[model samples]
Target: MSAFVDTLRAEWTKFRTIRGWVIGTVAIVGVIVAFGLMPGMQGSCGKNGPGSECSLPVGPGGEEVTDTFTFLHQALTGDGEVIARVAGMTGIATGEDPDKPNHTVEPWAKAGLIIRAATDQGSSYAAVMVTGGHGVRMQYDYTHDVAGSPDGVTAAVPRWLRLTRAGDTVTAAESVDGDRWTTVGTARLRGLPPTVEVGLFATSPQHSEELHTGLMSGAMGGPTQVTGTFDHLAARDGWTGAAWHPDVIGHADGPANGAPGAEGPPAPASGVEQVGDAMRLTGSGDIAPAVSGSGGLGVSITQTLVGTFVGLILAVVVGTVFVTAEYRRGLVRTTFAASPGRLRVLAAKATVVGGVMFVTGLAAAAATVVFGQRVLRGNGVYVHSAPAGTEVRVVVGTAVLLAVAAILGLGLGALLRRGVTAVTTAVLVIVLPYLLAMTVLTGDAARWLLRVSPAAAFALQQASPEYPQVANLYTPADGYFPLAPWAGFAVLTAWAAVALAAAAVTQRRRDA
Candidate 1:
C-alpha cells in the first residue's frame, strides 16, 4: 500500500510537470469560464421572473392554466415551422406562403411560435402555431409601414391572446418587449384535461440576407432564444394547468418496456409532457415548451458533460497514448522489473490514473454545469436548480465514471500492450453499445443493451422524481431489466474489475 501510494505521488508529479498536461488543464478551465460568462444570445430576461407583464388567457375547463408568460411589446416577429407531437408521437410539416410563388418559406420542424426581427433592416415578424393535443395558434404581422419604425410600431400596438382552458377559465395578456408582461384579461378556464405543455418558441422564415435581422434571426435561423417565467398564476384542481411540476411528471412512466416482468402503470392525466414534447394549451394552440422540465436542464447538461468526457478520454492524451507508449518504448520489462508483482503494478497505475481523472472529472462536471447553464439560459433553455444532495451526486457520480473510464483504459492498455490495439478497444467499448442500441434494439432487446451500457450508468446523474416508475422511457411497458443508477455503475465497475484481473493474470504469465 505504501509503495502504491508512493507510485501515485510520482505519477501525479509526472502529470503536473508535463507541459501538455498543464496546457490542457488551463485550456479546460478557460473554456469553462468563457462559456459561463457568455451573455444571452437574444436578450436578457433577468434572473428569475419579475420581468415584463404578459397575460395568458385561461380556458373554460377549469382544468388548465399557463405556468409561464413572457411578453414582447417590441413586436419582434417572423414566420417558421411548428412542432406538434406529444411524447413518442412523431410527424412533420412545413410553413410556406403557397399563394406567393417567389416568397414561399421552408417548413421548419420547431416546437412552437417563431418571432424573427431583422436587426439590420429592422424588419421582424412573430408567429405561433398549435401542433399537439388541444393546440391553439395566433400570429401578428407588422411592418414599419404600419407603425413607421420597428421600435415605434411595437410600442403603439398591443398583441393579445385569449387562452381558454377545458371549459372552465380564460386569460388574456399583452406585452411590449416579450419580457415584461401585463395581464389583459383572466377568466375561469373550462373543459380541459389535467395536464398540458407550456413554453415559448420563435423561428425565422427568410433565408435571404438582404434584410437586417435582430435577435429574431437566431431564433428563426437555427437556435433561437425562447423564455418565460411561471408566477402570478392560479389554477383549479378540477383541471390541469401547464405548470412545471417535477414530482407529478418526472417519474411518471411505465414498466421496463420489454423486460420479462417490468410493467409500468398507465401514463398520468397529463400523458407524459417532456420539454420537447408537443403540448396543447387552451383549446387550439400548441407549445413545444422549451426542453426545460423538472430536472430536464440538469439531465441535459450532465449528459452533455459525460459525453464530452467520453470523447476526451478517447481522443485526448492519456487514454489515447497509455498503452501505445508502453509498447513502443519497450517499457513493459522495466515496469514489470520495478514491481515484479504484475497485479500490484496494474493496481497502482489504475489508482493513480483513476484518482486524477476522477478529480479532474469533478472539475469538468462543475464547469459543464456552469457553462451549460449559461448556454441554456442564452438559448432560453430554463435550467432549474436541483436539490442540494442530487446536485452533489451529479458531480461526484460523473467524476467517478470518468475515473472508471480512465482505469479501464489503464487496465486495457496493460492487457493489450500495443497502445493502438488497447486504445481502439477502449473506444469500441465506450461507443459500440450506444450505436447498437440506436440501431439494433427492439422491445426486450433494448433493456439488456441499455442495462449494460455507459449510457445506462450515466442515467444515474438524472434525479429521478420520487416515483420514476411513472413516466420514464427506461421503465417501459414490460419490465425485464432495469438497473438503478448505482446498480448500473456496479455493472461497469465489475467490468473494470474483470479487465484488471485479466490484465494481472496476463502480465504475470507473459514475457514482459
Candidate 2:
C-alpha cells in the first residue's frame, strides 16, 4: 500500500507539472458547460413562447404535465375500495385532445379509473387502467406510472380494475376473473383529504403525425382526442353507490373550479354512455412529457448533459496522451526501471487521470444543475428538477462517467503506444457512436448502437423518460434511452474494464 502511495504521488507530480495538460482539463470542463447550456437557452416558454400558449398542468412536485381529459366520477369520503370489470376498452381521436384540434384515435390511447383530489387541474391522483397497445398500468398524479400486465386491450379478454385507499396510501390491483387479484402498484398522497373524487376515465394522446410534430417542433401541441367505451361498473365499501357525474379537467381557456379541465368549459364526453350494468367513458388528453423535453417544466441539467460528450472527448484525448506521450518520448523504460512493477505504474497513471477527471466532471455537473435552470428561466424556460436524491445521482453519475472514460483512455494509450492512434481510437469508439445514435440513427438502430457503445452511459444523466401510460413514440430520438440508466452505465463500465485488463496484460508481457 505504501509503495502504491509513492507511485500515486509520483504520477500526480508528473501530471500536474505539465501546464498544457492542466489547461486541457480546464478547457474540457468549459466545453461541457458551454455546450450543455447553449441548446435550450432560447426555446420559447414564457407567456407567448412555445409552451406558453397552453400552460401544461403540474403534479405533486411541480413537475410539468398535460392533463386535459373528460372524467366520470363519484365522491368517496373514507377508506375503502372500488372494483369494476371492464368488458372492453376502445377509443377514437377527434381533431385533437382537450384543447388541441384533432380527429382520430392514437395507438396508445387509454381508458381506466382514477381517484383524484377534485375535478381540478394539477390535483394529486392515482388510477389503474388499460391502454391501447401497452397493456395494464397504474398511473398517479401527472408524473408517476407503472405497468401491471403485458396483455393489452382485447375484445376477447375482459379486464378487472381496482383501487383501494387506506389513509394516504392508495393501492391499485387488477384481475382477470374478479376472484384472484394481483397488485399493480401503490402511491401515497400527502395530506389527502378523507373525501376525494373517484371514478372512471379515458383519454388519448397525439398519435404518430401530431406527436411527431410536437416532439420535433416543441412549440405546438394539439394532441389527438380519444374516446373509450367501458363496462361492468362496481364498487365496494366507502362508496355510497351514488350516480357518477362527468367532470372536466384541463380546459384550455379559463379557471377550473370542480367545473372541469384547465383553461376552458367542461370537456364534451361525446363518447360516454351507460348501457345496462356497464358505463362507457371517453376523454382526451395526456399526463406525460411535454414536447420541449422539459415536460413543459424547466429544462434540467441532467437532460442537457447530451452535449457533455464534448468535454468527455477532450478528456479522452488528454488521458490517452498522458501515457502515450511518455511512450513517444521513450520514457517508459525509465518509468519501469524506477518502479519495477509495470502494473503499478499503469495503476498510478490510471489513478491520477481518473481522479482528476472525476473531480472535473463532478464540479462541472454541479455547476450546471445549480445554475443551469436559472439561465433557462431567465430566458423564459421552465424546468422541473427531480428530487434532491436524484439531483445528487446526476452530479455523481457524471463524475463516474468521466472517470471511467479517463481510465479507458489511459488503457488504450498504453496498448497502442501512439498518442494520435490511441486518441483516435477512443474517440471513434466512444464519442462518434454516441453522436450517430443521437442524430442519424433510427429508433431501433439507435437503441442497438447505444446498447453497445460506451456512450450508453449518457443514460445516467436522463431526467426525462417516456411513460408507457402516456401516448408518444418512445424511442432514442425522443430522449428515452433503451436501457435503464444504471444498466447503460454498466455497459460502458464493462467496456472500460475489458480495455484496462488488456492493457495490463500487454504491459506486463511486452518490453517497454
Candidate 3:
C-alpha cells in the first residue's frame, strides 16, 4: 500500500512539473467560464423597456410551470363535487400559408373539470380532462399525470368528468354515460383551503412541428386555440357561488403566468358563454411544466455549460499525453524500474490524472452553473429553475463525468502508446458523437447515439427533466436525454473500466 502511494506521489509530481499540462488544465476552466458568460447570448424577456420583469409561475412542488387557460367556475366551500360533460372539442393550427390556417386540434389540448385552491396561476389544483388525441387524463399541480381512458369525445359520445374534493384529497372520475362512472385517479393537495374554485376549463398548448432540411433543423409553430362545449353541469354539497364566473387565466395579451414575450401572437380572445345549462369555453396556452424549446422560455442551466465539450477535449488530450509522453521519451523504463508492478504504475497514473481532472471540472462546472445563471438572468433570459438536489447532481455528475473521461483517455494512451492517435480516437468516440447528435441527427437516431456512446455522460449536466405529460421537444439539443443522469454516467464509467482492464492485461503480457 505504501509503495502504491509512493508511486501515486511520483506520478503527481511528474504531472505538476509539466508546464504544458498545467496550462492545458487551467485552459479548461477558462473556456467554460468564458463561454458561459458570452456577451452575444441575449434575450428579449425583460427587454420590454421597464417595469416588465421576466418570470415563470412556480407550481406546488416548486417547479416552473405554465398555468394558462379559460375557466367558467363557481366557488366551492368545504367538501364538494363538480361534474360536467365534455360534449365536443376542436382547435386550429398555423399553416405555411398565412391566410389559410390549418383546422386541427393539438394532441395535448385539454377540456376538463378542475378544483383549484384559487384563481391565481400556479396555485394548487387537480383536474380530470379529455385531450384532443390522448383521450382522458387526470393531472395535478402541473406535473403529475394519470391516464384514465383511451377514448375521444364527441357530441353523441360525450365524456362525463367529475372532481370530488374531501378534505385535501381530490378524486377524479370519468363516465361514458351519466349513470356509469369509473374512478380515474386521485391527488392530494396538501394545505388546500376550505373554499376553492371549482370549474370547467379549456386550453391548448402551442402547436409545433419539427422541420428538417438536410443538416439544418428547426421548429415551426404558432398560437392555437381550443374550444370545449360543456353540458350536463351539476354540483353537490357546499356549493357557495350563485353563478359561474368567466376568467381567462394567464391572459396572452398581458405578462402574467408566462415568461415575458413568450406568448407569440395574442391568442384568439378567450372567454366563457352560457346558454341555459351548457357552457362554451375558448382558451389557449398550456397548464403544464415549462420546458425548453418551442413555446418555452429561453433555456436551462445546461446552456451555461456549453463549454464542457471543449473542456473535455482539452482534458482528454492532457490525459492521453500524460501516459504516452513517458513511452515516447523512454521514461517508462524508469517508471517500471521504480515500481516493478506495471499495473500499480498504471493505477497511480490514472489516479493522478483522474483526480486532477475531477478537481478542475468540479471548479469549472460549479462556477459556470452558479454565476452563469446570474449572467443569463442579467441578460434578460428566463432560465428554468431546478431543484437544489438536481443542481447538486449536475455539479457533481459533471465532475465525475470529466474524471472518468480522463481516466478512459489515460487507458487508451497506455494501450495505443501514442498521444496523437489516442487523443483522436478519444475525441471521435466521445465528442464527435455528441456533436452529431446535437446538430446533424434528430429523433431516434440522435437519441440512440446518446444512449450508447461515451458522450452519453453529457446527460449528467441536464438539470431539467423530460415530462411525458408536457407537449414540448424532448430532444438532446433541448437538454432532454433518453437515459437518466446516473444511468448515462454509468455507461461512460463502464467503458473506462473495460479500457483500464484491457490496458492492464496488455501491460502484463507485452514490453513497457
Question: What TM-score would every model get versus the actual structure?
Answer: 0.48, 0.78, 0.95
Sorted on TM-score, best first, the list reads 3, 2, 1
Compose the digit string of candidate 3's lDDT tens values, residues 1-512.
99999999999999999999999999998998888877656777777777567777888888888889999888879887888899988786533332444447788999999999999989999999999889999999998999999999877889999998899999999998878999999999999999899989999887767777887777777767788999988888767667888998987565322455555555666789886778999888889988876546568898888888899988988888999999999999999999999999999999999999999999998999999998988887778888888888888888888889999999999999987898898888788999999889988999899999999999898888888887777677777788999899989998899888989999999998
TM-score of 1: 0.48
Candidate 3 deviant stretches above 4 angstroms:
94-102, 254-257, 275-277
**Residue 132 in model 2: shift from native, Å?**
2.2
Top candidate, metric lDDT: 3
Model 1 scores what on Cα lDDT? 0.40
Query: lDDT per residue, candidate 2, 67-164, as tens digits?
Result: 76778888888888987766665554333335443333455566788888877777888888887777788888767778889786555888888999
Q: Which is superior by lDDT, 1 or 3? A: 3
Higher-lDDT candidate of 2 and 3? 3
Ranking by lDDT: 3, 2, 1
Q: How much is 504 displaced in model 2, in angstroms? A: 2.1
Per-residue C-alpha lDDT of model 1 across residues 1-512, encoded as one tens digit per residue: 78777666655665566666556545544443454445533222233355421112222221111112122112211211112211111221123222333431112211232222222111222333322222223332221101111111111332222223323233333334344444433333222223333323322111111111431111111111111212122223332323332211111123111111112232112221223323322110121121112211112344334344333343234643544465678865776676566666666667766776677767867777656666755554334445567667867876776678667767777778777788778767765664555444543565677677654555456543322211113321111125666886787687778778888888778887
Candidate 2 versus truth, CA RMSD in Å, comes to 5.6
The CA-based lDDT of model 2 is what?
0.73
